[model samples]
Target: MLPEAKPGPARRLVDAIRYGNSVVLTLLAMLCALLVGAIMIVIADPPTRSAMGYFFSSPWDTFTRGWHAISAGYVALFEGSVFNPDSLYSNGHTPIFGPISNTLLNAAPLILGGLAVGVAFRAGLFNIGVQGQLIMGAICAGYVGFAFRLPPLLHLLAALLAGVIGGAVWGGIAGWLKARTGAHEVISTIMMNYLALGLLNYLLGISGFQAPGSNQAISRSVHGTARLPHLLGPNLSLHLGIVIALLAALGCWWLLTRSTLGFSLRAVGANPSAARTAGMKIERSYVVVMLISGGLAGLVGCSQILGTNHALTGDIDAGFGFDAITVALLGQASPRGTIFAGLLFGAFRAGGVVMVANTGIPADVVLVIEAVIVLFLAAPALIRAIFRLRESRGGGVGVGQLAKGWNA
Candidate 1:
């Protein structure tokens, strides 16, 4: 009888297992960064110095007690951010939904903004104006949400539509500059971002447009009818905007993969001259994609106002528009990737507080750990070295290579 064939470890493992390994590897990098950070803390002072002592006590006690405390705290952060926790901190029934809801709420806008950045990336456009577009969209949606007199559902829809219009118009101007004058989108978008912010503030604070009897510069409260409904009772904070964001992602997936318009977009992004030679509307593609991007960014503002914040204020967006850039990059410009990345970032934000509150670890350390993760994520080289990924720089796509066409 023929000898039985021997199998290597790679062949023995299932494809699902291999795929799961990749995800684990990424998480491992995050942990690795934390480990490195801990080592630095230990070497710098050994729990005796100002910074180190602030977290724990003496060095001898640190190894036995401090080390475990920090590790457990980080783990708690992970648990609190992603999974359901039925246990209560106090006597009250623990709302397992807290982290999950916050994750979705924080991610809702990231999804839309991620879509915006992802589309521009695909078209070789380095569109950085999502921040400005986001601000414009929020203020636009905010204005309509409070200023209108339509039925509730209609009012909400109208507010969202206004945001789309506002963002599209803003983005369209940049696209026009690009197509007509050959201005680089990176520069134009940067300028436009500032313009959007200034314009938004002006519109909201203007006497005629400002809320009555309110000296402070802010929009009026949204009509009860215009506000998004929470599936749970009013006590809960989640809303229908999450549903809208998901639908938008599905819609974008369809548009990019299946539609004729998508094909044209890809063609133009790949080669504008070639597209022109083949009779594709190159200028129109540039204009439309930026508008779509703007609209998507605007939707983020709408979701924030209509779903959660319930009104427009200067504080809206809270740098989320800027944060969405990291989200888009980390997600590799994929819709599902964006969703997951958004959750990861949101979880870090949610859990960092608790980790600090429960343990004596400084919250800023948690923030540093998070920042390091994204830094490493954006540079696959850092992750590759840490985990020894065999793939060479040219072997396959790298994380830094996600966005294309902007230099053109």
Candidate 2:
């Protein structure tokens, strides 16, 4: 046999460009999103708009006003998400901790929701019923939290467990339908979301679930014993759910990388026919993957109902289920990537409030920025063309991979 020749520097560089450009693409997408946001900010500013009317007479004034609006808007975002020098003199709590706390508080549920989506993606299943699963879990957890009372530790554990079981059962239903009946997950999941919402509305009308003497579609507040413990004292809203989310991410990392089941899942995802030929139980794998995915989504519910809100409301979802899809896509459906992406979205959530309050920028602009980011992520070919990056050899696990998995 002839000895193999090593790859040259040029070949290695090409390989890196092909396989290692995900991070670069992500950064450029974010920059482009921010630039788009800046334009919207300038357009929305009354002073900038007034200046623009007479741009030929005083171009510098228009430019100056626009720059000032953009800077102020982003500065508020930074202050709300990260730290504020002015917070040093704030009363009671530690300096610069409030913003960080808010970010963590918002990120906890997002991280869990993203993991729910990411895991299903890894198994070549597009589990789009996270919203429904999360709602079912919250319903179970909320009932357990208020109707029955145990010791503080036991009560919390029972509520959390109930949430997991509720979500798993809901997800398993979809899995079973797909496996046995050949029903498409996308259509089934979308239907389930509406079903879940209707169920919640009906339940909230009952005296047992509804808040006493209240006409709103909201459940009774959970008992203190069932509530997630505050992490940084009562001054901050940070809670134990953030710890749970991080631990869940760690567990998911192990589940997808080091476990035997992980190998089967990846194999099935890559090629179901080959996996079946290799003796893997494809049907069983589908059911199991959906169960786990739904369970993760349940944790997201726990974070909201038990950790933050302390009660289940009609708007309890707050669209986190749908946002999880964006998070999963941006993270490339990896555990570590999902964590970072969740944090980034959480920052957007935390900062957008301040940006609106301080800069008078419309709240819709924040949504616009988030939508733009997902737009770029969903179209990797567009990102490649914009950045002039080389495509990977064969095909890579980008949005196209996710789309391909839908057919699988």
TM-scores of the candidates in the order shown: 0.84, 0.93
For residue 86, model 1's alpha carbon misses the true position, in angstroms, by 6.3
The lDDT for every candidate, in the order shown, is: 0.73, 0.87
Q: C-alpha displacement of 392 in model 2, angstroms?
A: 4.6
Give lDDT tens digits, candidate 1, residues 1-408. Answer: 999998677764543233324355457657776876565434433343444554454456556554666566667676666654544564446566766676677777877888888777767677789888888888788778777789877887898899888877888888888888889998999999888777867877877667788988677787887788985657657688778878888888888778998778877777778889999988888888898888888888888888888767777777777777877776766677777777777777777666666655666675566667677766655666665665542343444355443212
Q: Lowest-scoring 10 consecutive residues by lDDT in candidate 2?
A: 399-408
Instruction: Tell me, by TM-score, which candidate is best.
Output: 2
Q: Score residue 192 of candidate 1 by CA lDDT.
A: 90
**What is the per-residue lDDT of model 2 for residues 1-408, given as tens digits with 9 covering 90 to 100?**
999999999987777666536676687789889999999999999999999999999999999999999999999999999988787776644556888899989988889999998888888888889999999889888899999989999999999999999888888889899889989877888899889889999999999999999999889999999999999888889999999999999998899889999878878887889999999998888889899999999888888889999888888888889989888888878888889999999999999999999889998888899889988877878877876777766564354577534222
Q: Give me the candidate number with maximum lDDT.
A: 2
Native-referenced Cα lDDT, model 2: 0.87
In model 1, the runs with Cα more than 4 Å from the true position are 1-25, 33-59, 83-93, 356-363, 392-394, 398-400, 403-408
Each prediction's RMSD to truth: 4.6, 2.9
Q: What TM-score does candidate 1 reach?
A: 0.84
Look at candidate 1 and give me any clashing residue pairs. 124-404, 124-405, 124-406, 152-225
